[model samples]
Target chain A: MSEKTDIGRELDGALQKPKRQLAMVFDLNKCLGCHTCSISCKRQWTRDEGMDNMWWAVVNTQPGKGTPKNWEDMGGGWDEKGEPRPSKIPTRDEFGDAWKFNKEEVFHGGKGKVTYLKPVNTKGESPDWGPNWDEDEGGGEYPNSHFFYLPRICNHCTHPACLEACPRGAIYKRDQDGIVLINDKQCKGFRFCMEACPYKRIYYNHVQDVTQKCIFCFPRVEKGVAPSCARQCPGRLRFVGYLDDEDGPIHKLVHQWKVALPLHEEYGTQPNVYYVPPMSPPAVDSLGKVDPSKPRIPTAYLESLFGPRVKEVLAVLEAEKEKKAKGEASELMDTLIVYKWPEDIFPDFVQDPAEL
Target chain B: MLVKRIDVNGDVLGDPAASVWSTANGETVPLMPTPAAMQPTKYISTKWQNEVYGQTKSVSVKALRNADEIAFRLEWQDPTKNEQRIENTDFPDAVAMQFPLSEDASLFMGGEGTPVNLWYWRADHPARARSDVAHGIGTSRVMDDVSISAQAVHANGRWSVVMRRALSVTKEAASAIQIVPGQTVRTTFAVWEGGNLERAGIKAFSPAWLELEIEA
Candidate 1:
């Protein structure tokens, strides 16, 4: 499918331009798949009863079914003709219902010896799936098998399908930082946003009867503090800043170096989250011979996830790495290294959360 | 359809199973599923299109009015009772009655210039009902008034709902359809089966407007 459309362009035109568009760039090569970002996000937001299952920032093993289980196969977002593709609402089971262990029976009950502790869901049934059920289960044979951590959150698209799909006009894109939010009072809990979102990031709060998603930590952003997921990341792989800020690492990595590419650009939402494709070591043959030309993680598979620009981005990264190894001043490599902490990564939002 | 008039001080006729309703011949209105093509494009593209509901082909409706109030008793077969919205995927069983503000208002929720008054009742909220105004599809807004009293009971695979309101409201609402003695009005009905996960436009609706004449 074509990447751009006149309808999408017109939709962008109708919206009031934000003073600055906030963006994020994630270097996949640096990701450790530790899920510190996910845990930090959970502690900050999603601690309620219905929100227990919500993982606003999820790190999934590539080439495997994502958080919602086979979410890539579920259609949403705009098609080639800029029309909404038919989709289905991901069930609680599909999203992996929060499991409840029999703590009382195991610890306090007198018949502890006969009955063992087991995890049961809210519906009183054993859960079959979970957020990281397929964690580290990559694709291909033993010697050629490979995987990379794909951390996902709300893209906060320039042309968000969730915003357009809301009939109540409850979803709005802020004119200041271009953050998309749903107005709780106006939201009728229809869940159209959940279906229209190609990323399947939006979640339903059964207690409140409304749909919820990653808010981009607007409360922190307003106070010049970065989101918990970005701030708490130990890898220092996530860079946050306004796209127009030429001096910021986001612009350097995304536009200047051209190493970061948006995931599934074919989804046609103009996603703001970009990824620096992962490079892998050469694959080994059954005869114990290493094939230098054949990378363990196929480039074609990466291209399918990040679009056709994967090859060029990888080539640029390789060239820059070579320059840096030769003791040359490579600006791209220096930025990726993140010499300073918050100051070098999120220049605009550098205020410490504790200080705020 | 004729709305039988009762003396205001004599006896209340709010019960759905009351013998007074039996005296009037109940109309068996055939209900058809609201076409998927007619639903909002977003809804048509979602899992709702695959929803299998509105299987009930018909419903029995009877109406009665006293000097102070008017009431409608709708009875339909529903094998399940889905009254809770506590679960993420749970949808409540619901029903709505529609009346036009003008004589020539469109039967399909009225047009832009012509609005419709809607009394919506859900099984989850059994005590009271919502008063809403709709200009057209996707333009429904709940008004800030608790003007209608609703009570529903499910038994033996059947649902009996009674929705009642005063003949004249003290407060004025833009979409309120005036109900007076010796007046003829057009009305429509919609039912949602929560077990089938039906909500919004995915429902069974009366194909044509039913003309009701209030007895003087």
Candidate 2:
């Protein structure tokens, strides 16, 4: 008998197949940039003395300075040689600190402003631009002003740069699910991996002198439960699932419908996480008639990620949104579907041997 | 201290990449050698049965530095003997001839002190050692960088101490120059340090000058 086609074989063995990737999809439009995600994430992983300033998951407002301030500006992921690039070291300010601010003057107002002694960040240090720096501080006057929240975490990558930079071979990615993790016991604290990461998401634990970053909730994920950041989000904007699970939300959001886009795809790390593209109102002249064809998220912004194919992706999303608005497509676009699981959260998972 | 010269002249006994060589010079000269570590990969493994095993060789290197001319004020319990190499009169002459280390003492009170006795290591030499009346030898150094050097002796009477740091540098900050292997690496340093001059744990020799050794 002739061999079955690949698709036919895959169809027959669908239940036996395990997803090779774990990813998250963020709906930037619904993200409040509330530290709830950051706070929940911090409390879960970084509560230790050494892990103090590590905000493995943080939210930054667009058009505002990022966690490492101008993280987008610091260079190092891909080399000019087209070879893999490494991460750069983040300063104490990048991790942020409890800056001494003048509460006395702000309440009293006039006196501090005129005296040139108004509340200011202490020197030899920088001011605390809390996890959320520019939220609600959108530009433009009256009602037309706007800004969006961008919550970020370590993008567990397919070709993880941090993994390559570790000389001690302490950091590793699970072959089964692609979860990036640091082997704390083996880590020598050399921190080369931190410098190699373009995201600047990994942090140095001063007290322990080891390096740490987002683990994609390995323990929870292995049990088939979502991460703390995704589970506790009040906005219900985050979705977590395996990339190969066709029935799962992450698979449908990123591969099936394809609205979710990986941030900075040019880095070529093949980041597992995805984003439900943020939308902004199209630009207009003095009058306020909305342009039907123009997409909310700028095409220029999309180009940075999906490249020339961005127009195609945006077109598809817009079409889906329109169809949903007309009551034709599934109401998925308008509503955030948070999966409710029992107390025993986790997936009945079995890892793959090839990844081992 | 600056590098005096290097002896990167020829072939490494076995694999060329097995080790590196270099040299340096300063207040004290050192004969630095390679870690000289060789693994199975470092040499052509010979097959025993069906498995391959590596051969290893070990060597030791000793370095030499100039010892400060001490006053040799050795006082002992033994009765005065004719074998005494230094006369009691010699110490007075050496002290009188030595430069006066003038210094103001109130530095402890945050006041600037004048120059005084030079900084010196009171450590005893193992091989060339003997106790004085106070159970220690009285030694002194000139207020200048005392030139010192190191040399190595190989197992086969063959020696290879690279011309490490140039011996011309002054002692202050550049005193104990580090010796590293260059292209022509030095072999070992048993001959440089006062070898055969003293025995261990017994000799109470004190160096008026101190030299340091480092590993690469």
Candidate 3:
């Protein structure tokens, strides 16, 4: 199909170039696969009936099926020619509906022995799948098994497929910070955005009849406080800053050092969030000898996600690690280490939420 | 089709199976799926291209109007009553009627400079109907004023809906069809079966416009 169309052009025309774009970078090497970010995000935003299953910030084990199960196979966003790709709205069952435990029957109904604690879905049936159903079930056999935590959130793309797919024009990218948001009042609960977002981050709010997603913690950002997911992360792997700020870690990692790469660049949405490819331990032979030449996690697999730049990025990262290990100064290593908490990372958004 | 005029105190014709509706001839309009090729290109177009949707094939429609208001009774076969939007994927059954603002307006939702007024009713919002205006496909906007009222009932494998509206609405903030006591207007109908996840442009629509004349 032909790439360009008047409709696509018209949608692009409506967007104003933001003065500064807030961006995030997650170092996979440092992630502990903990659900702290997910929990913090849930406590801050998604704590309602329809939002029960929503995990705005999720850490899916790579090489395993991610949340919503095989989301990578679901087509969405723009194709190679910049044409919109078709995608389905993932059902609550596919997303793993929030399970309801039989607390009443187990605790108060005098059937504790028989009922115990059983989880049932909204339809009163045992749930078959959930958000983290494939947790830790990474690829390969036991000897060569490998996995990495892939922390995910809305990329808040420069050319958001969700924004373009909205026929009501309800989704908008803020001109100041390039934060994409769906106007709740204008939204008609159409859910076209959910289908168009390749990352499958947008969620449907059945109660309110509108689509909801990560707001990038705009309320906290406005008060100069880091987002809850980033602020409460125990691994301290997430870095946030304006993409244009030359002094910020985001720019240094994404543009200057070029160590961090956007996931699935082929999706063509221009996702703002980047990832520092994980460097894994060497593969083991049948004799239990470590093969230094073969990384446990295949480079071809990482290339499929982060594009051809994975090899170059990994090489630079390894060189930087070598320098740091030999007691030599490596600005890249120091930035990734993030020794000074919020100050060294989110310099522009340094104010604590409590103080604010 | 002729819309017979009823007196203000005449027997209520809200029920589709009411004896009064027997007097008005029912039109069996053949319905066809809104072509997937014509759906908006952004999302739904590709997802539903090959999927068989809008399985409903036809509907029986009867019309009645009083001196002050107009009413329509639409009946179609539906196995289930999908009244709840409680699930993220659940869609409520719905129906709509379309009228052109001008005589020469395009039948396909009207084009620019030719707008169409639409009265949309959904099973979830059973208490009232919403008023919307469309310049063309994908150009519909819900009007602020909701002057249309509707009630729907599903029983015995069918949905019976009764929708009523005033003859003329104040044009200050809303645009509506000015229903004269004795005037013929062109109209069309569309129905959505929520069980099939039908919404937006994924619907069954009347093949062609039907002419309606109000009794003087």
Best by DockQ: 3
Q: Using lDDT as the measure, which candidate wins?
A: 3
Error of 2 at B33 (Å): 17
Best prediction by TM-score: 3
Q: Candidate 1, clashing residue pairs?
A: none
Write model 1 residue lDDT over B93-132, tens digit each, in one string. 8888899987677777777988898988899887567888
TM-scores for every candidate against the unseen true structure: 0.90, 0.54, 0.91
How would you encode candidate 2's per-residue C-alpha lDDT over A28-140 as one tens digit per residue? Answer: 76887677989888888889876666788988776566777777766545554435453346665655643455556654765655554332232334465654565667555
True contacts kept of 1: 0.30
DockQ of 3: 0.55
DockQ of each: 0.41, 0.02, 0.55
Candidate 1 stretches with Cα past 4 Å from truth are: A1-8, A12-19, B7-14, B35-37, B42-56, B77-89, B102-106, B110-114, B155-157, B175-178, B181-185
lDDT per residue (tens digit) for residues A68-109 in model 1:
999998888889987888676787788888889988988898
Q: RMSD in angstroms, all models? A: 3.3, 21.6, 3.6
User: Residue B70 in model 3: shift from native, Å?
Assistant: 2.1
TM-score for chain B in model 2? 0.17
- For candidate 3, give the docking quality class from DockQ: medium
